[model samples]
Target: MAKAKVTDEQIIQVGSELQKADKNVTGHALCKVLGGRPDRLIEVWEKHLLESNSDENSLQYIQLSAGLEELFQSMSNDILKSIKSVLATCEQNILTQADKHVENEKVACAERVSALREQLNDANDIINQNQDQIDSLLKENQIINNKYQKTIELEKSVVELSTKLEGYTTAIKDKERIITEQAARIESINAA
Candidate 1:
C-alpha cells in the first residue's frame, strides 16, 4: 500500500499538541502521532524550525535548495561543480575568520596576563624596599634611645656630686669660726 502524504497543517497541529501536553510530550510522542519514527520526525521538525529562523549565513543549504530545481533543469555539470566549489570557499572563509578571532582573543589574554605579572612583581619589590627602610629606621631609633638613657644616668651622678661639695664647704666654715673664738678668749685672759 502507498503511504499518504501528510499536510503542513497536520504537522503544525501535532507540534502544537505536543507543546500543550500535560505530560512530557517528547519528540517521540510527536513522531508517533505523525505515523513516523520519533528520531526521524524530530530531526525534520527541528531542521524546519531552524531553517525558518536561521540567519543568511546559516541558511545556505536552504537557499541553495530553492535554486536547485532550476539549476538541475538547465545548468550543465561544469556549472554545478563551480557552484559547489564557490560554496566550499565561502565555508572556508567563515572558518578562517573564526580562527583569526580566536587567535586575537588569545593574544590579548596573554598580553594582559603578562602586564599583571609585571605589576605584581613591581609591587612586591616596592614592599621589600619599604620593609628594609623601616628596619633601618628601627635600628637607628634603638641606638638613639640607648644614648639618651646613658646621658640621663650621667646627669644624676653630677647632681649627687654637687650636693656632697656643698656639705663639705659648710663644715670648713664652722671650723674656722671656732678657731677665731678661742684666739679671742686667750687674749682677754692675758690682758686681765
Candidate 2:
C-alpha cells in the first residue's frame, strides 16, 4: 500500500477531538475536514488506531501473572523463614532465662544451707556452754559434800573425848574415898 499522504498526528488529533465531542471519526467526516480520500484515510487511521490501542492496553493492563506469582511465593518463603528465625531466638532466650533462674535458685539454696549450718553451730556452742556450767556446778556440789562429811566426823570425835574424860574423873573420886576410910580405921585402933 502506498504510504498515505495524511500525517498520523493530524489523524490522531482530529480523532481525539471527535471522540471528546462524542462524534465518530468516519471516513466521510474525517475526509471532509482533512481533505483526504475518505476510504484511504479511514483505513490507515483505523490501522494506526488499532496498533496504538494495542500498545496502550498492554501498558495499562500489564501481563504480570507469572512474575507476580513468583514474587508472592518468594515473599511467603522469606516471611516464613523470618518467623522461624524469630521463634528460634525466642526459644533460646527462654531456655537461657530458665537456666539462669535455676542457677539463682541453687545459689539461694546454698546460701540458706550455709546460714542453717551457722545457726546449728551456734546452737551447739550454746549447748556446750550450758554443759560446762552444769559440770562446774556439780564440782561445787561435790566440794560442799566433802566439807559436810569432815564436819560430821569432827563432832563425833569431840563426843567420844568428852565421854572418856567423864569416866576418868569418876575413878579418881572413888580412890580418894577409899583412902579416907582406911585412915579412920587406923586412928580408932590406936585410940583403943
The model with the greatest TM-score is 2
Would you give me the overall lDDT of model 2?
Answer: 0.87
Q: How close is candidate 1 to the true structure, as a TM-score?
A: 0.47
The list of candidate 2 runs beyond 4 A from truth reads: 1-76, 172-192
lDDT against the true structure, per candidate, is 0.78, 0.87
Candidate 1 wrongly placed segments (more than 4 Å): 1-91, 179-192
Q: What are the candidates' C-alpha RMSDs? A: 11.1, 25.5
lDDT of 1: 0.78
Deviation (Å) of 19 in candidate 2: 63
Q: Tell me the RMSD of model 1 versus the true structure.
A: 11.1
lDDT of 2 by residue, 1-192 (tens): 687678878877877788789998888888878878888768867987899889988886665699897997799999999999999999999999999999999999999999999999999999999999999999999999999999899889888888888887887778777777878888898889
Q: Return the clash pairs for model 1, or none.
A: none
